[model samples]
Target: MPTPAGADAARRYPVDPNSRLNVRSGPGTNYQLVRVLPYGASVPVNCQKPGETITGTYGTTDLWDNIANGQYVSDAFVYTGSDGYIAVRCS
Candidate 1:
């Protein structure tokens, strides 16, 4: 799959240290389950988009982070330092 622009430059962030996060096919839970991230996994968020609001270890938000092509994880489970978009918005 083609990687998003700036993906190589994307900064890696820690997932919720205490939980294994779900990777979805889209930006919401309604989407298919793509994979399950391992505990203590750090991911590079390529982009972000608005999705179903989720309350996770970090905080509640509607942001879903694109870690790879067709791979998304709830931002509430990722620590990007701020409770806001840190990367480019997904197209």
Candidate 2:
């Protein structure tokens, strides 16, 4: 799907049970570790702040596989890769 217009577009990330993702310091796995998010968590794809990188595993590479947010729930998505994005479980 095409990205929406404006800053909100950048904040939004694709969410799917099969969509691989990583929980890191920044949006990409290149940063420090925070945790590994599994499937079933309420990922907040459209609520990231500016300049704050939502760290996560590569989702598609060995470097990413090393990172682990923790465990998977029922309402979580499986991060795949760059195509996949960072997400946070909602309360």
Candidate 3:
């Protein structure tokens, strides 16, 4: 599907500059940790899901961003410029 106008390919969102966000196998901290995003990294949110709510640099939420297949990061650390879903909800 085409991305919304003014939003890049899925809209790359900035990770909290002070954080090295954890990439997980699933949408919550209970999931396996896959990796850590670099400081100042930005990520394209392919989709989203609601999971364990977390509080981070951006605020608090249960929203998790799927950055790749089987990879996710808490939306609380992503600067998506909104408090709601910015991409399609993951099936």
Candidate 4:
């Protein structure tokens, strides 16, 4: 379905600036690594859901952002600008 005209989509940003962002099959480290995003890589957050807390160079948080179908990354690894929910919750 198409988004309604002028409907706001969540803003996207380059989540990392220094380290390579690890893309995973799921939200936790236990999940398999699927890809490695280079520094300043584009990581568009589709939506967010609560998952495993990861302590990376950024900080610690259990929040996970869905980048694609079945693909998730810990919010701690990405700089979402806002510390709280900035997008719609995943259904």
Candidate 5:
């Protein structure tokens, strides 16, 4: 699949060390599940969009990061340091 332009170099966020994070087909839990990201699995956040709110170990947030062409993960399940590094919005 064609990747999002320049997304690979965006700041990387590893799934939070506490648990496996869901990688979904879209930004919300209602979307199909794409994969499961184990702790320490890091990926660049290509962009972000508003999604279902998820209260993960890190905190609660309604943001989702598009890490790949059709893959998204809840922002609450990833760690990009304090105050997530803002990324471009996906088209």
Candidate 6:
């Protein structure tokens, strides 16, 4: 089997201790809250995009399907405010 994109082999980014990380369905707050990621959670960020202003849509929509098996982060990457971050699976 081929190694998946943004798989466990990918480098994980540590959650900022000061930032209030919101776990959304998609890569925006418009998405539903799957869960709130606490500080220190190591999230796998496949690609980082520049900040862009867009209207909120579906809550917790599957956005990171291209990365893993789609089962991991159906709704992972999200844009919270001006900063962008990926949601990591908590152990």
lDDT by residue (tens digit), candidate 5, 1-91 = 9989875566687787877788899989999999998777987888888889889867898888899899999888878665554787777
For residues 1-91, write the lDDT of model 1, one tens digit per residue. Answer: 9999866656699999999899999999999999999999999988899999999999999999999999999999999998998888999
Better of 4 and 5 by lDDT: 5
Q: Which ten residues in a row have the lowest lDDT in candidate 2?
A: 58-67
Task: In angstroms, give how far residue 18 of model 5 lies from its true place.
Answer: 2.2
Query: What TM-score would you give candidate 2 relative to the actual structure?
Result: 0.31
List, residue by residue over 1-91, the lDDT tens digit for candidate 3: 8867856555588999999899999988999999999999999999999999999999999999999999999999999999999888999
lDDT of 2 by residue, 1-91 (tens): 8766664323422345444444555434346656544554334243222232233332232212212233221112323334332443222
Q: Candidates' TM-scores?
A: 0.89, 0.31, 0.89, 0.79, 0.82, 0.42
lDDT of prediction 2: 0.35
Give the C-alpha miss distance for residue 48 in model 3, angstroms. 0.5
Ranking by lDDT: 1, 3, 5, 4, 6, 2
In order of listing, the candidates' clash counts read 0, 29, 0, 0, 0, 9
Candidate 4, 28-57: lDDT as tens digits: 888999888888776778888877878875
lDDT of 6 by residue, 51-85 (tens): 22332322333343222232123232333222333
The Cα local distance difference test for each model comes to 0.93, 0.35, 0.92, 0.77, 0.83, 0.41
Candidate 1 has an lDDT of 0.93
